[model samples]
Every structure is written in structure tokens, then in C-alpha cells.
Target: MKERGQQVDQNSESFTFLGKGTDFKGVVSFGGTIRIDGRVEGEIHTTGTLIVGEHAMIQGIVSVGVLMNSGKIHGTITAVEKIQILKPGVLVGDIRTPVIAIEEGSRFHGMCDMGAHLGSGERALSLDMAPGLVATAQ
Candidate 1:
């Protein structure tokens, strides 16, 4: 059987959506890599990479393995592997992820706890709450 979360063939046709002119509302979930070039107004969950193109706009939660943004987002994000915000990217919400890379021109306006780098890769659900990915101390 194929391993869970294995990368899709780089040579195969990938999934993509152009949202620059369309308005989307509701949750979005997918397995393979995806690129959004429009607007989304709901939660998004995916096992593979999720790319928010430069002209894209997102206004909800995002949970995925790898997230890269060159657009504008107004919600929380939980990324298991990594998060990257390229130049001109704008984010206005909390973030919980293992690895994060932000370009000099990017703007972020919210709380960030980089504790995931400690290896647990778990972000505390709340300041007084246990991280969702780990067992709590008894």
C-alpha cells in the first residue's frame, strides 16, 4: 500500500483553482497539492501542499501539511511541516506550525508561538490549553 502522506508524482498533472475573479464560500478539503489563485471564505484542510497565489485572498482557517502564501489571509493556520509567506503576503491571524519562513516585505498581525521547533510540532490550542497534537501532562 502507498504510504500515507506520500508526495504526489511531481510529473503528474496537479490540481489547481483560479479564484482571482470568483467568490468561494464553504470548507475545502483535498488530498494532493493545490494552488489557489482566487478567493476563499471558509476552512481549508489538505494533506499536501496548499499554495495561495499572489493575487489570491483567503478569509478562514487553514490546516495542512505545507502552506505557502503570496496573497492575503485573515484567519488561523495550522501547518504540520512548514509555512512560508513570500514578499507582499499579508496575514492577520494566529499561526501554529513547525517551520515558518517569512519574506521581508510580508506583514503579519497576530500571535505566534514557535514552540513547534522543539520537535513536538504541536501548537497549544490556547494559552492554558494543551496542544492538540500531544498528550497532556497528568
Candidate 2:
């Protein structure tokens, strides 16, 4: 019925929605997708996607698998997969993710670490150990 990796077509999915005028504090965690359109102060951790609506304002830490933001966020964000900042989004904090997309009207003012190291068990091939029948061949 519902898919996890599908970006769009979230209507079919059963997601958690925090509408406008809602206020929340402390940490929130869940699976699947969630949409926030209100004000939040504290941390949010999820293994699923997080969609921040245009009227949302979030502070503190955010850790999720994927993030789609169209609001204002002032804190650290760590996404395991990717992050998308849509139009009118304002993110004012550091982020760590493998992939990121910022729209033209979005504003991101902070550091971004796209992973300083390679994936697990992955490494650059050394010429010394590589065989190409060149001068380095012994």
C-alpha cells in the first residue's frame, strides 16, 4: 500500500502530520514519513523521512534518514541519506549528509559535511598494488 523510498506520492502513505499552530518540545522519533507545519523546540530523530512544511520552525538537533525542509531550522541536522531544502526554506545550522539539494529560493547558512571518508570497506586503489603493466609493475 505504502512505500518508503518514494519521494512523492506520499498521500498513499500513512504519515504523521503536525499541522500549523501546533507547538512541541523535547525529542520526537518515528519511522516512515512525517510532516511538520508548526513550531518545535528540541530534538527530532527518525529513521524515516521528515518533511518540514513552509510554516514550520524547528530548533535543536535533528537526525533522520532523509529530510525535506521548506521551513526554518536552526540547529544541527544529520541525515543518513539525503537532504532537500525546498523554496523558502531557511536552514541555519550545520548538516551532515551524503547528498543534499538546495533550491534557488532556499537559504542555507551553515557547515555541511558530506562525509569526509569513503564508505565502509571502500578505499582508493593504490597504484603500487594495482597492475596495469606500467613502470610500477614488478
Candidate 3:
């Protein structure tokens, strides 16, 4: 559940990036937890939590378990479980997830949906914010 303001359980895993000192350019796939401290320019697939640092930048697609962003993301994001946009976070693309947390001070200019719960396979996140597109967020 989300309040008028965005909030997530702190008990959830946390990841941080220092930013301004790292750069990445390729496809990324991992499990456990991921935190972007610099920059990424490719497709990202993970089975753990993903955090985009305040100054980090991402320019590609992302598919993960959970996502919390405090930076800039310019691509599509497919999260299987949940997503949170921290203050000052900027996201400019489509989002496919079951749960979304949008903070008061964040910037998100895109469509989103929540229709991935009706399938027989691994439950995917739905992007009801759009039409005619189905994605797997989990």
C-alpha cells in the first residue's frame, strides 16, 4: 500500500551508488541486488533489487525484481514486483509493474500498466498505463 506520499519498507534491501565516477555500456544480467552508481547504456535484467543512484544515469531497458530510482532513467522499465521513485528521480519511459511508488518530488513522464497478474507463467507486471503491450516484470 502507498500513502499520499511514496514510501517503501526500509526492511527491504537497500542499494546505493556514489555516482559521477562510474560508467557502463552493455547488457547486464544479475541476481541478488544491484545498485547503479555511475551510468548504464544497455539492457538490464536482474532477479534482485535495483537502485539507481541520485547522479547515476541509465539509457536502456531494465527488467528487475524491485526498483528504486533516485537518478535519471531514459528507457523502459519492467519490474516484477514493485517500484519506487525517490525524490528528484527522473524517469522518461514506459513502466510495467504491479506496484509503483511515485514520490512527490520525482519526475516521471511516461505510461504505466498493471496487467501482468493474469498469466499462467511467472506473474509479470502489467502496464495498464498503455495499451496492447504485455511485459514480464518479475
Q: Each model's TM-score, in the order given? A: 0.74, 0.77, 0.72
Residue 93, model 1, lDDT:
97
Q: Which stretches of candidate 1 lie over 4 Å from their true place?
A: 1-10, 117-138
Better of 1 and 2 by TM-score: 2
The reply for model 2, stretches above 4 Å from the true place, is 1-14, 121-138
At residue 114, candidate 2 shows an lDDT of 83
Q: Cα lDDT of model 3 overall?
A: 0.79
**What TM-score does model 1 achieve against the real structure?**
0.74
Model 1 lowest lDDT segment of ten: 1-10
Q: Identify the candidate with maximal TM-score.
A: 2
Model 2, residue 48: displacement in angstroms?
Answer: 0.3
Residue pairs with colliding backbones in model 2 are: none
lDDT tens readout by residue for model 1, 1-138: 111222345668456565557667888888778778778889999878899899989999999999999999999998988989988899889999868899999988898766766756655566356454355443
